[model samples]
Target: MKKNNSFTIRKLTLLIPGIVVAILTLQSCQEDETTELTRDEEIAITENATFSEDVSDEDIEIANSAEIEAGIQEPASRESSSEKCYATTWDAATRILTIDFGEGCVGPYGRQRRGKIIVSYGEEGNYYVADRTITFDNYFVNGNQITGELYVEKAVINEEGFYENNYTVNYTILFNGGTTFTLNGSRKREWIAGVLDDNFANNVFRITGSLTGISTRGISWSHQIVEPIIADFNCRSEGNFLYTQGIKEISYSNSRRKRTRTVDYGDGICDRSYTIAINNDLITITAE
Candidate 1:
C-alpha cells in the first residue's frame, strides 16, 4: 500500500475514523506480520498522534470495558489500544453532591448568609469521573482568613459511574445576624443565587434532588443573596450534630428564618418531626 505518510492533523481529524479502522486491522494481523516497523512508518505513526501522551489506568480501564461499544468490532487489546487515547469521563449517570461550609465559616457575619451550593460531575464513558472534578471553592480572600464548613451531603458512584445528589437550595440574603430566609419553593439559579453573582443565573451548577434539576456555581454576593449549605439531619438521640450511631428524630435551625423543614424521608416510616431555630442563619434542628 502506497501510504501517503504525510498527513495534516486537522485534515486527519476527519480521516481518523478510517485510519483507526486500518490501524485496528493491522494490529490484528500483527500476530502474523512482523511487529518490526520501518523507520519511516514509525515516524509517521508517531507524528500523526491525536490522544494525550500520559494515558492513565482509568483511561485504559474505560476503553477496555467498552463491551457495549457503538461499533461492533472486537475491541483491541489494552496494550494495542493504549496509544489511541480518544477517551473521556463523560457519562449518562448524574452525581449528587451537598457542599457544607463548616462552623468557622458560619459564625457571626458568615452565619447571616443563607442559600444552597449545587455540585455536579460530568460523566465520561459508562462511569463518573471522580478525580476530574477537583475545583477550589475559593474561600480565603487572603488564603489565610477562613470562611465556613463546605459539607458534602451525598456523593455516590453508580453502576454507570456518576455521582448523584438531590437537595433543596436556598437563595435569601440576610443583613443582620438575626435575619431570615425561606425555602418556600424551588427556583432556578437566575432567581436564587443569581442575586449574589450574575453567573449563578445560568445552569452552570447542578442541585442533586430538588425537582427543578441541577444548577451552576457562581460568585457569592452579600447584598442580594447568600449561599449556605443546609443540613437538616435525623438526630438519633439528641445534641449530637456529628452523628455516630443509634440516632433518633432530626433537628435543624437556619440563622435568618424560623422555617419548618418537613423532613419526611419516606412513607410515614421515618416520618419524624422537629422544631427549628434561626439563630444566625443556622437552622439548628434540635431533636425533641
Candidate 2:
C-alpha cells in the first residue's frame, strides 16, 4: 500500500508542472497578440495622415464666384492671330451671323457662317407679293455700321453649333408664300480690304486656328468651359495675303476629354453641303 501511494504522488507532481507550463505559454501568446495589435495601429496611423487647408468654407465660395465670371479658367491656348491679321464688316448683322472659319475663307456659299433677320410675308395669292429671309455671311466693322451681304434664300434651320448659330440650312430659296422665286447657292469669294494686303483672298499663309472651341462646353450659356482653340489652317490665298484664325474652345465634352477637331470646309457657303474623305480622316464641307 505505501509503495502505490508513493507512485501516485510522483505522478501528481509531474502533472502539476505541465499545467503551470501551459498557463505560462497561454499568457505569452496573449501578450504577443496585444503587441501585434499596437504595432498595426501605429503603422496605420503613420502611413495614412490627412492634411487639410486652413481656409474656411465662406472663402472658398467667394473665390469660386469671382472665377465664374472670367473665361481665363482656360487650360490651353490656340491663338493663331499672331501670324495673321483680320477685320470685320459691321452691320446690325454681325451679331446674327455664325462664322465658320475655313468655310468662310473661300467665302462662297458653302456652309452657313452667320444667321440674320428674315422678313417673311404671306397672305393669300397672286399679286406677286414676297418677303425675305435675311442671312449675314460676312461683315466689316466700318466707321458706324458693320456691313455684309444677306444670304437671301429659302432656308430651314438645322442644327445649332457652339454659338447660338444654326448649322444646317436649306440651300434652295423657294418662296411658296406667293410668286415663287428660286435662288441658287453661289460662292462669293470677296477679298476684304486692308487685311494683310489688297489681294488677301489669294494669299496662302497657314490655317493655324479653329472656329468651334469656346462653345463646346454647352451652348445653353450655362455650362461652359473657356478653353481656347489652337489650330492653324495654314495655307496661301491668291495674293499671298497672310490669313490665320485663332479659335478658343470653352465647352465640355461627354468623353470628358476636351477635343479640338474641325468641321468646316474652306469654302464659305451657308447652304452648301460637303463630302467626307475616305482615308483623309478630315471633314470636307462643300456647296453641292
Candidate 3:
C-alpha cells in the first residue's frame, strides 16, 4: 500500500506541471485572439468611413474664410484719369491681374510705398468680383511691409443689394523680428454707395470680419469686429471698428497662457486709434 501511494504521488506531481503549461498556453491564445479582434475592428471602421460626412460646419466656415481673406488686399480701382495711380495688366491664361505701383507712390497715412501685387481669380463667375488669390511680393505700406500670400475664396455679393461682398480668407504675414502671423476667417466689404459709379468721394469702404491669427512666437489671437472698420479709398485712415462684444482672445504655450481683450473704437470718433482692454488695463494703438 505504501508503494502504491508513492507511485500515485509521482503521477500527481507530473500532472500538475502539465496542467500549468496547458493553462499558460490557453491564456496566450486568448490574448492573441483579442489583439486580432481589435485590429479587425479598426480595419472595418476605416473601410466604412467617409471623410466628407465627418466635416463640420465650423470646418467649412474656416476654409471659406481663408479663401476670401486672401483676396481682400486688392488695390482700390480709381476712376479719375489723373488719379490712375496703379498701372494694371491682365494675364488671360492665368487669370491674374498685376498692378504695379509706380515711383513716388504714396499710400494711406502718408506712407511712400511701391510694390507689384498679383491677383489670381477663381473659375466661378457668379459675382462681379471673383474669388482671388493675392500675392504681395515685398509690398510695403509706410515703413512697414507685407510680403506673403493670401487666399480669398467664395466671394459673393450680397443679393439684397447691401453692397457687401461676403467671403472667407486665409493669409500669412511675415512681419518684423522674424515674426509671422497667420489668419483664417470670414469678412465682408461694403463699398460706399455709388462708389462703383466712378465717384471718388464715395471711395470709402467698410470692413467687418472675424479672424483667428497665430504668431510665430507661439502666440495666438482671435478677434471679431463688432463695428465695421471704415477705410478710405485713398488710404487716408483706418479705424472706427469696435470689437466690444465680439471678444478677442490671445493665448500662448498651447493655451496654458491666455488673455482676453476687448476693442473699443472711440465712441464713433474716427481718430485712426483704437483701445484694447486686457485684464481691465486699456492699451491704445494707433494705426500705422
Ranking by lDDT: 3, 1, 2
Q: Give the alpha carbon lDDT tens digit for every residue of 63-174 in model 3.
A: 2222223343233342332233455666657766666665548632234546766667787641235666666656554333455455555544566555556555455544
Lowest lDDT 10-residue stretch of candidate 2: 49-58
lDDT of 2 by residue, 1-288 (tens): 247887899999989999999999988877655553342332221111100000111111112122212221122131122212222222233222122232222222111222222222222210011112333333211111112222222223224311111111122121123211111222111112222322212222111211121111121111111222111112222211111222222122222232222323224322223222223464333211
What stretches of model 3 exceed 4 Å from their correct place?
A: 1-85, 102-104, 123-127, 143-145, 153-160, 192-194, 232-254
TM-score of 3: 0.56
Off by over 4 Å in 1: 1-146, 151-156, 159-162, 165-175, 178-248, 251-262, 265-288
Summarize candidate 1's per-residue lDDT along 1-288 as a digit string, tens digits: 665656655677888899999999877666323333322322222111100100111111222233113231132221222122122232234542323232223211112112222234334322122322221233221112221221222335445443433222332212133322222122111112111221111111222122111111111111111232112122211222211111112112122221222221222122233222222332323221
Relative to the true structure, candidate 2 has a C-alpha RMSD (angstroms) of 26.5
Query: In what order do the candidates fall by TM-score, top score first?
Result: 3, 2, 1
By TM-score, the best candidate is 3
**TM per prediction:** 0.16, 0.18, 0.56
Candidate 1 lDDT (Cα, whole model)? 0.24
